[model samples]
Target chain A: MHTRTLAELGDALAAGEMSSEELTRHFLTRIEALDPRLNAFITVTGEAALEAARAADRERAAGRAGPLTGLPIAHKDIFCTDGFRTSCGSRMLDNFISPYDATVVRRLKSAGMVMLGKTNMDEFAMGSSNETSFYGPVRNPWDLDKVPGGSSGGSAAAVAARLTPAATGTDTGGSIRQPAALTGTTGLKPTYGRVSRYGMIAFASSLDQAGTITASACDAALLLEAMAGHDPRDSTSVDAPVERYADGLDRSLEGFRVGVVEEFFDEGLYPASAAAIETALDVLRSLGASVKRVSLPNLALSVPAYYVVAPAECSSNLSRFDGIRFGYRAENPRDLADLYKRSRGEGFGAEVKRRIMTGTYVLSAGYYDAYYLKAQRVRQLIAEDFRAAFAEVDLIAGPTAPTPAFDIGAKTDDPVTMYLNDIYTIGVNLAGLPGVSVPCGFADDLPVGLQLIANHFEEGRLLNVAHMFQQETEWHLRMPGGEFA
Target chain B: MALTRRQVESIANLARLQINEDEIPAYVRNLSRIIDFVDQLEGAGTEHVHPMAHPLNMSQPLRADEVTESDDRARFQANAAAVEAGLYLVPKVIE
Candidate 1:
């Protein structure tokens, strides 16, 4: 049951081959036995999951089943799940139970899907590696010593290890794609506002968007179809029609023009990873997609601009955790200001604190013009560069990460080096475009990913191209030989 | 662009985070490194570019100002650290 994708699991439920209870139980048991090895989950809602699964079985029995009926999936702890804890991988919310379900959680639950649990993530989705998670880092399923790329690492790890067939992830500057690349899972970040952000915790609200991680593009498509739609509560939610993502998976890719970002192939990329991406491009060509080298020259500017913009927004967004509301509060305080300082100081982890301070510095009165406003202008240049490139091609392709997963502590000493992990993935978010990472092949016996990016809201075409390449390659099917496997 | 320890401390103070005295140096180092790294943006000329606040240049969507929500303050405040009679408890701002 854990091996089957959501689609196959749905089919089995419809065919009465297994009840949702049994399937949910199987995954719950796997998580219990396997998650300690990965720390992939922050909380497991076994009892609630079983109850939901039983209800799904009843739905199927009554001929009221949907495509996602009886399928169990993990929600990243960032999303608010009414009766469960939504930790967002930070101690600030460690004891905070959400009062309402995030829009994504509600939609999936409505489709008769059972929530297995909430997977861990970097605190407030800030770090490149899961190491910053207040719960402790999620280890890569491929190799225990290697870090799972983050802040969506736990979701990628959970899906890759088949702990749950799929999970939700949020990407602000490659949180979804980088981890998916490093852990060898399929991850997608839809266009900005394609999925409602009403209840997902804000981390750089403009750059933050909810996405999906799964074993294959087909499964990602399946989950995204259920999660995508406008919400009145989310002011930025796109008031456009949601694509039938799964239905578009079989679209033919004949004569598709794939723009290969020439800048992404420069010296920083690892050779073997480059080789794997080249092979994946050939597979796309075999499917009748032609590759052309297109440049988004302003690509180099995104990381710096993002460092400014993301933190600035986060500093403002996180101000709500001032020891007065739903999050952690100090036991006692000398004064109101002391209460605010102590509560936040003890509640948040290091990376989050550093970002808060960085944001504070950038948005400070004297520095605002030099950092915040300046970065926003550079952000415009980056977006315009993408708009220009999209005019010449239907999609863009590149290596998801410069290299495969690094050893857990390899780059942690220097924050800048750690930030570079998202070098290829951040530009997509800066431009508010949709992108997906598909397992292409392995480098140094570790998985490599080919990132496919499309213009705003072209997720159907992007998924179709990925599905076509995946049909010709078996990389996505290669399960890790970690403890669970 | 290397920030002094005094400056780092002041930044943390402004952010309402109490950094331990021993951890202050690392923050200074890391923050300085980050500032220096992002200094790369200084080279990009954007004299005429408009600073973007939204992606895709979409203006803020406007809708009629009307109450569409029923009161849920009680349910919403259920997760608060402290509350009394439907009011969130906080350190007194006035004596």
Candidate 2:
């Protein structure tokens, strides 16, 4: 039961083979036994999960079950849940019990999914490795010594370990896809504004997007179908029709034009991982996809531009954490200025503070045009490059990460070196295009992910392409045990 | 491209973050390297290009000017550090 994909689990529940309560208990038991090994979960709402499962069983008995009814899933600690504490992996929000549910949480609950718990993440979703998490780093299930890439590391680890069938994650510059790559999970970051951002804690307002980490593209399609749509609460949420993504999964990939980015296979990628990506492209070719060599000339500038733009936006967004209203407050403040300073300095982790200061510097009086404005223009060039490339191809493909997961403490000393981990994935976010990282093969006994990017609002076409690849390959089904041994 | 220590201190103040004296050196070092790294953006030819603030180039959406949410002061105040008489308390400003 624990090994089954979300789609398989839903089918079992629909066939009356097992009750939702029974299925929820099965996962809860696995979480109790395995979660300590990975530190994937920050909070486990077992009692609430049982209660929700019972309700789902009652709904199924009443003949009103949805496709997601009774399925258990975890949420990255970023989303606000009414009763559960939404920590956002920060000491500042460690004690915050939100007054309402994030739109993503509300939608999934209405679809009858059971909440297993809130998974851990990098503090304020800032770091590439999970080491920056306040709840401690989530170790890769495949190898205990390596990181499960972050800031969506907890969700990726949880899904990879089969602690939960699926988990929700937010991507801002590869948070979802990078971690998914390391953990051998299927991760999707939909086009910006595709999923409403209401009640999900803000990281980088323009770049942030809610997505999923699941066992297969099929499960991602199911979740995306339920979660995608406009909500008036989030002004940026696109007022576009949400497609029935699952219905498009079985579409043939014949005549599909795949453009492999020439820059993605540059010196940054490891030889083994590059080989894995090449082999995966062959599988796509065998399925009748015509491979074309393409180049997004401005893609290399993504990291530097993202560092400027994301921090600039985050510094503004995170200003709400000032001591007076909510979040952490310094004790015995001598004045208002001290209250604000000490509260933020003490509350935020080092990486978060570094970003806040970086933003403050770039957007400062003398440097705004030199740094912030310059970065924004480069971002435009990168987006324009993607537009040009997509006109000639139906999809773009590349490696998700440079290599497999690395040691936890390897890149923490140098922030720039750490930021480059998302070299292949960040360009998609800069352009607001949807992208997914699906397991392709293993390198050094650890998993490598093949990233697929689509033009804006092409999530259905992207998922269909991925589902067809998954049909021809069993890479997504392999678990993380032999490597552990 | 490296930021001076004084600049780092001023930036922290602008961001309203209290950095202890001992932590200043590390901040100066890390912040300098990051700034140097991002300075590569200056090389790109952005002279005639329009800057993109939004990803989709969409303008902010406006809504009808009506009271959309009911008063939930008590519920919201529960998360505040100190609240009295239905108002958030802060350090006194004027003498």
Candidate 3:
């Protein structure tokens, strides 16, 4: 019951073999027993979950069940949930019980999915490793010593450990994909504006996107169908038609053109991870995908460019957390200036503050053009590179992270090393393309992720490709202590 | 491109963040390295390249100017640190 995918769970519920309330209690029991070891959850709404499950069961009995009815899923704390404390894994928002539900939350609830609880994440969705989380790091379920990746680490870890069948995650530069890579989960970051950003805590407005982490791409398709669409509340939300995503799965990958980025296999990548992805590409080839090496000349510049653009946007977006209106406030401020400074200083974590300051400095009077403007131009070049490459190929494939998960403290000292982990995944966000990370093979007994990227609004095509690969390979089905270890 | 202690201090002030004195050196070091890192973009050949603000190159969409939302001022203010007579209270700005 715990290891079943969303489809299997849905079938079981539809067949009247088990009640949603019983299924929810099963997962709730597992979470209570296992989540303490992983630190994957911030708050577990057991009472609310049971209540939602009971309602779903009652509705199912009355013959009104949706595809997602009675399925329990966790949401990364970044999204606001009415009445639940949407901490966003930050001290500033520790006590913030949102008055409204994020569009994603509302949509999923309407689909009859039971909200298990809010999963932990990096503070303000900033770091590449979950260590920066105010709730503490989420350890990889495969190996407790290594990180699960971030800022969506908690969601990834939760999904991987079978604490939940699926979970919601947000990616700004590789938060969703990287964690999914390290934890051996299927993570997707849809094209920018594909998922409405309304009520999701802002990180980098342009790059940030809500996505899903599940046991497989099939589950991703099911959940994404319920979540994708436009909401007028988010100014940047694209007014586009939602795809019947699950309907497009089970398609064959015959004659698919897969492009391998020449730069992604450079000297910095881990050899074992490279080996894993190479074999996965061969599996794609057997599934009828023709492979060719492609180039994105500005690929190496993504980290630097993203650092500038993301931080600048975050600095602007995070300004709303000033102590007066809501969130944490410094105690006993001597004056207005001190209130502003001390409140911001105390509320934000080190990485958040560092990003804020970097953003502040770059957008400052003398440095704006050199840092911010040049970075934006380079971002344009990066997008152009993708544009030129996608002209010849249907999809791009690579290893999601340079390697599998790293030691918790390994890259904390130098921020650059941590920044480089997303070296492969960030370029997609810069260009606002859809990308996914599916479990391919193992490195050092840990799982590796094979990344698949497509042009903008090509989420359906990407999901179909992933589903085909998943059909040919059993990597996505390998669970902890099943075969690898 | 390395920032001095004073430069980081001033930037923190500009951002309205109260970074402590002991943390200044680390900020100077990391911020300098990051700034230096982005400096590589200086050499990229972006001649006549228009800086991209949106990924899809779509202009901000305009909607009909009409009231689409109802007033939820009291509900929204429930999380405020201090509130009075339908308003948020903050440190006094005017003398």
Candidate 4:
């Protein structure tokens, strides 16, 4: 039951071998038993989930179920689910229950999927490691001491530990992919606007995207099919038609053009990560992919540009929580200014405040052009670099991180070192393209990931490629040592 | 581009957050590295390019201005540290 994919569970549910209630109970029991050690969930919606599961069972009995009907899924804490506390992993929102559902949550519920719980994440989705989570750092199930890479770390860790079969994740600057890489799970960040952002707690609005982290590429495809669509509520939601992601899972990779970015491998990559990438390339070549070297010369500057642009946007987006509208407020304030100051000072964690301060500084009156405007210009150049490279290659490939899971607190003191963890994954976000992290091999007893990046709205192709590679390898099937606790 | 300790304190105050004096050195050092990294953008020369705020250029279609949403004032204010009726309570200003 722990290792079963969503498709298999759905088939079992359809065949009358298992009821959604039973599956939901099994996962709930597992979460209750293991979540203390993992800290993967912020809020577990047991009653609501069981109620949804029972309803799903009845719907399936009526023969009105969709592909995801009767399946259990967890949401990142960032997505607002009405009646459930959507904390965004911050003290500011610790007690705040959403009045409405995020678009993704609404769509998944409409598809008849059961909502298991809300998973933990970095406070306001700020950090690379899950360490910045105000709820406490989520541990990698593979190794209890190492981090499960972050912002989406709780979602990745939950799925990997079988606390949930599949979970929703949001990526702003590699939050989903990096955690997925470290936890030995599959995560996909669709093209910006491919999934609606309505009701999702904003971090950096321009770069944020919602996707899935599951056991397999096929599972990701199933969730993506249901989650990807335009919503009138989200102004930035793309109106393009979503493709049948799971329908083409068996597509042959023969004659597929896979481009390996030279800069990704040239500098700042760990030797083991480099070797795992090379080995994955060999696997792709064996499967009939024509591997070639491509260059995105300006790709090296992605981390720097992202720090400016993401923080600037975050500072603006987070200003709405000023102790007057919603969320936490300071006690016994002397005046409105003190109320604002003490509330924010107490509510937000260190990293979030650091980013807010940095953003406000850069976007201030005297420094806008030298910082914000210049960063945007560099952002264009980075986007153009991907545009030029994609013309020469169908998909880009590289190591997801410099190495596998680093120990917790190894890079905590140094923000620059922590930011470097997203070096390979950040470029895709800057270019507004789709990217995924699939388990390729293990380095130093930890799982390493091979990143697959495709052009905008190319999610189907990216999943197809990932499915082909997964078909030839069993890495995605390997579970961490534990009997589903 | 490196910020002095005084500048860091000023920025922190401007953002309405309180940081300990001892934490300033570490924050200054780390923020300086990141600022230096972003300073490279000065060479990119973005004179005429419009800042692309979003990926898409289309505007969201507007609907008739009807209230599709009901005010959940009670539920929303449940988490506030202090509240009265439907309004959020805070320290008075202009007294």
lDDT of each: 0.92, 0.94, 0.92, 0.89
Q: Candidate 4: where are CA atoms >4 Å away?
A: A483-485, B45-50, B57-67
Clashing pairs in 1: none
Please name the candidate that would achieve the greatest lDDT relative to the true structure.
Answer: 2
Count steric clashes of candidate 2.
0
Candidate 1 off by > 4 Å = none
Over 4 Å off, model 2? A482-485
* Tens digit per residue, CA lDDT, model 2, A1-485: 87899999999999999999999999899899888999999999999999999999999999999999999999999999987789999989887889999999999999999999999999999998888888899999999999999999999999998999999999999999999999999999999999999999999999999999999999999999999999999999999999999999988888899999999988989999999999999999999999999999998899999999999999999999998888899999999999999999999999999999999899999899899989989999999999999999999999999989999899999999999999998999999999999999999999999999999999999999999999999999989874322
Query: What CA RMSD would you report for each candidate?
Result: 1.0, 1.1, 1.4, 1.6
DockQ of each: 0.81, 0.90, 0.84, 0.61
What TM-scores do the predictions have?
Answer: 0.99, 0.99, 0.98, 0.97
Best by DockQ: 2
* Residue B78 miss distance in model 2 (angstroms): 0.9
TM-score head-to-head 1 vs 4, winner: 1
- Candidate 3 pairs with clashing backbones: none
Error of model 3, residue A225, in angstroms: 0.7
